[model samples]
Target: MRRVVIIGAGLTGLSAAYHLRQLRVEADVLERETRPGGACRTTSRNGFHFDLTGHLLHLARPESQKLLREIGIRNALRSHRRRAGIALAGCVTPYPIQINTYRLPREIRRDCLLGFIEAHLGKADSDTQPRNFLEWVLSRFGDGFARHFFIPYNRKLYCTDPAELTTEWVGRYVPRPDLADVVDGSLGLYRKRVGYNATFLYPREGGIQLLADAIAATFPPVRLSCAVRSLHLGAKEAVLESGEVVPWDALVMTAPLSHLAAMTADLPAAGRAAAARLRAVAVVNLNLGVRGPAPRREHWLYVPEERFPFYRVGIPSNHGAVAPPGCHTLSVEVSLPAGAATASGLRERCLEGLMELGLLRDAADVVTVDEVHLDPAYVIFDAARPEAVSTLRDAYRAAGVALAGRWAEWKYSTMEDALWDGATVARRLAG
Candidate 1:
């Protein structure tokens, strides 16, 4: 029997454990936090339940949906009526940008429509490699749409200019609407919603934590509150915190690559240098308990203006039954570059933004505020990112340590992607 230790206990860690149990592999999970879910935990305060962020389960592939069903939580899944819009120049536009062109000012709308037509007329004969996120957005949606929506939204969400980021991160994360859909949308004739995230699933009772907890429960050997400080990677052994050394033929690490580098202090200087160059965006989630139901029609609202500190706002009450009746909850998500700002400052800015946007109306509408900071929430895919990530990954592989999850893989991934990565790690270990 092979003994495996999984770190972090997030959706990825729990999924890995669950899959390992299915294979009858011996495994133990070590989580630094007292709870299992890392960023997906749900907490209740003063009769209001709040997730770290409003997590809506939207699977990119059928295999992911199948896995959800296999976990038996599928029966508990309820799909939300997709209600989302982008707040631009004090007006709410239908989300996915293309479907709601009527919300924009007449001139702006005409320009956008014309740009779309021109882009189609000048369509390339062959696929041109996008130099950056800006080029990618323009190439896909034209300059008008890119400047009006994609650029501002992405800048707020990633805390960096789109031009500084790579285009590889755009795959599946952003949807490209066809010319017919764009025309129909412009003519107010499009009936179908635009993107894959139009409708998403959530658990009936516990929110997304249900999925993580269920997976963790399947593997009983998980150790909680065990923070891994360092790793002593040898030819046939690995050691964790509390001086407990576990001998293993192989090791798998799902922790952030930066943390992994710190763990393997004995690695070559070049490897450590490459790891240091890898940058990540930290996220501050301000969960606010509000009076009554949500004021908007959508599950989420995107802020593309500089007036708002948060790039996106999610109302759990709009999507799931987790929030208390007569009381709604909003998760204000602000992405900050690492060391860019403090959580308190960011929270205050978000509140101010909410006031300016008229979402909060008055200070009295706020019942409670719970703040959570998720470090390394986004991996910045810059020109140097691929090289840095590859070097670190190769170094870890050479040292016999497995890497998985968003930060581990250094990809801008959805929750489904993280779960898939975890399951893949488990299969490799099981085999």
Candidate 2:
């Protein structure tokens, strides 16, 4: 029996433990937090329940479906009604922005439609590679869509210009509509919802955290409040935070690659330098409880206006009975570059914007507000990201350490992708 140690106890760590147990492998999980589910945890305050951020499960692969079923929460899953919108130009437009371009003013809509037509006619050959996110959006959806929605939304979420990011990260996350489809949708000739996230599933009782908690429960011997201050990977021993040392044949680490690099004092200078180049974004979640029935809609609302500090908002009561009756709870998500500003300032800006957007009628309606700041929530994928990630990966492999999860892999992945990565890594270790 091989003894394995898993760190973090987030979705990725917990999933790895669950799969390892299923395969009858001996394992122990160490989590710095008292509870499991790093970003997936949900908390209740004054009769309101809030997830760290609104997470919806929308797996497009059969393998993901199998993993969900294996976790025993398959029956509890329910798809939300397809309802989402974007706040643009003081009006709410249906999500996918392209499908609802017709809702714009006549002049603006005409400009967008004409641009789409012209770009479609002069389409570049498929063989040409898009140089940046902006180019990718224009190449796929045309200049109209890029200028109207993609550019602004990407800026809000990424906190960087789209031209600075790479396009290989855009596939499957962004939908590309044919010229006929765009024209028809804009002209009301025809319409369709296209994207992996169009429909999503959530737990009926607890929020998405239920899935992570369930995975954690499967591993009974998990160590809580155990932080990994440093790791000394010797020829046959591993040292942990409490001055305790444990001998091991192999190690699998799920900590952020940047943090891992900082811990390895013996790592080559070149490896350390490459790790410094990897950048991450911070996310702040402002969970608010309002007095009202659930919002008229279930899907999240994307805010694209410069006036709003939040990029998106998710209503929990709309999901089901998770939120208290007659009280609406929402998660307002704001993405910022690391160390952009203080949390208080960001919270104030978000509240003002919410009031202006009518999401909050007034300050009086806000029953409670809980702010959560998550660092390294997103990895900025630029042209250099591939090289940076590859360099770190090779260095870790050489040290007999394996990396997993979004931070470890340094890729923008959905919740399903994280779970899949965890399970895959566990299986390989067990075999």
Candidate 3:
């Protein structure tokens, strides 16, 4: 294909451009925002940097880590052992909640451990698929673990019942402890961490956005603030909001599948229906730069209890000097319905939640707070999602469009996943 065009300047699009250029293939990137990074961008205010979300650089794949080093963040990245926790029973306990139940009350610990053991021994080698996320958890983790942490925490994160979600996206992101590991962890005797992100890397400075910045540097200026209004598959053209039509022989779309489907001119009816049925969770970040002790005591915490509106809260200062010395920056995520607007007290509610959790001794401890809205954050993997997304993907291939990135693929993915997706598509297209 000639005259290639990549849509969205997020890490995926940038990676595609970088790889294509290395292959001596010229490609242009278009972004709706003025900045390059999408959710990966960071904001600096009064010497404190607030990452837009809980953007941790967990290098699960060696190839992805090597690429980051090649992008010039090798020396700048600092590795930190994960010190995350879960809030339950009015106390903060070590993370991988199922395994770390020793801190719970006597009855709770017994129930969790017994249930886990029963599941471990009786978990048959059947081939029947779990109908939903709840069933998957119940079958694998049993009642105690499911009721206590898995269900509540996920419900808070997705803002929906777990039974509504499909089990397709769990892949390797969630930590699944074995019988030995679970027994040891629950007894406070587990020495080894058992999770996908037991340890992660972050830039020594500039928040998590540096990874996106470094990748963006290798590509030419992206057409920023230029939202695509329509795509003509027949003519191989993308129509911009400014009424400019750009022609291309091939296209890489990193925008949300719904947006792409809406913009495309002659997409099949099934594709349109699939896009319309897709579900996602909206998220808002109450980013606070405070004068109190940094939330550094623990890197991040998952709030499984329903008393708080936020599902997760992360302190960037815990990983590095993201804030001024002795000061801390908090990034809190509140999940909402997809496409729903107007969270009236989301910011205030988040601050109050921090106060209740004792993270903030009082409101006076706060210095500055900013609310950043990720309109469509986590794509919910409901049972209908896979089929819907498949219909869209099949249509996309027919229309000669390559999908890249988490949102484009409509899956819950990591930064490494995005980078690798771009590289894979670029390699195939280059040949």
Candidate with maximal TM-score: 3
**Candidate 3 backbone overlaps, count:** 0
lDDT of 2 at 428: 87
Clash statistics: count for each candidate: 1, 0, 0
* C-alpha lDDT score of every prediction, in listed order: 0.79, 0.77, 0.85
Better of 1 and 3 by lDDT: 3
At residue 401, candidate 3 shows an lDDT of: 94
Any residue pairs clashing in model 2, and if so which? none
Task: For candidate 3, write residues 158-270 as lDDT tens digits.
Answer: 98899998888887877788888778878898777867789988888778788888988886888899899999988889999999999988899999887888889888788
Candidate 3: 10-residue stretch with minimal lDDT = 120-129
Query: Any residue pairs clashing in model 1, and if so which?
Result: 83-298
In the range 211-303, model 1's lDDT, one tens digit per residue, is 787677666857887888777665445565777766655666778888788777477788888988888888888899998767776788888
The TM-scores, one per candidate, come to 0.94, 0.94, 0.96
Residue 159, model 1, lDDT? 84
**Over the stretch 287-366, how does candidate 2's per-residue lDDT look in tens digits?**
88888765547468888766678889877778746656677887899998875664567777887887787777777777
Worst 10 residues of 2 by lDDT: 231-240
Model 1: residues >4 Å from true position, as ranges?
A: 63-66, 125-128, 235-241, 343-345
Instruction: Using lDDT, rank the candidates from best to worst.
Output: 3, 1, 2
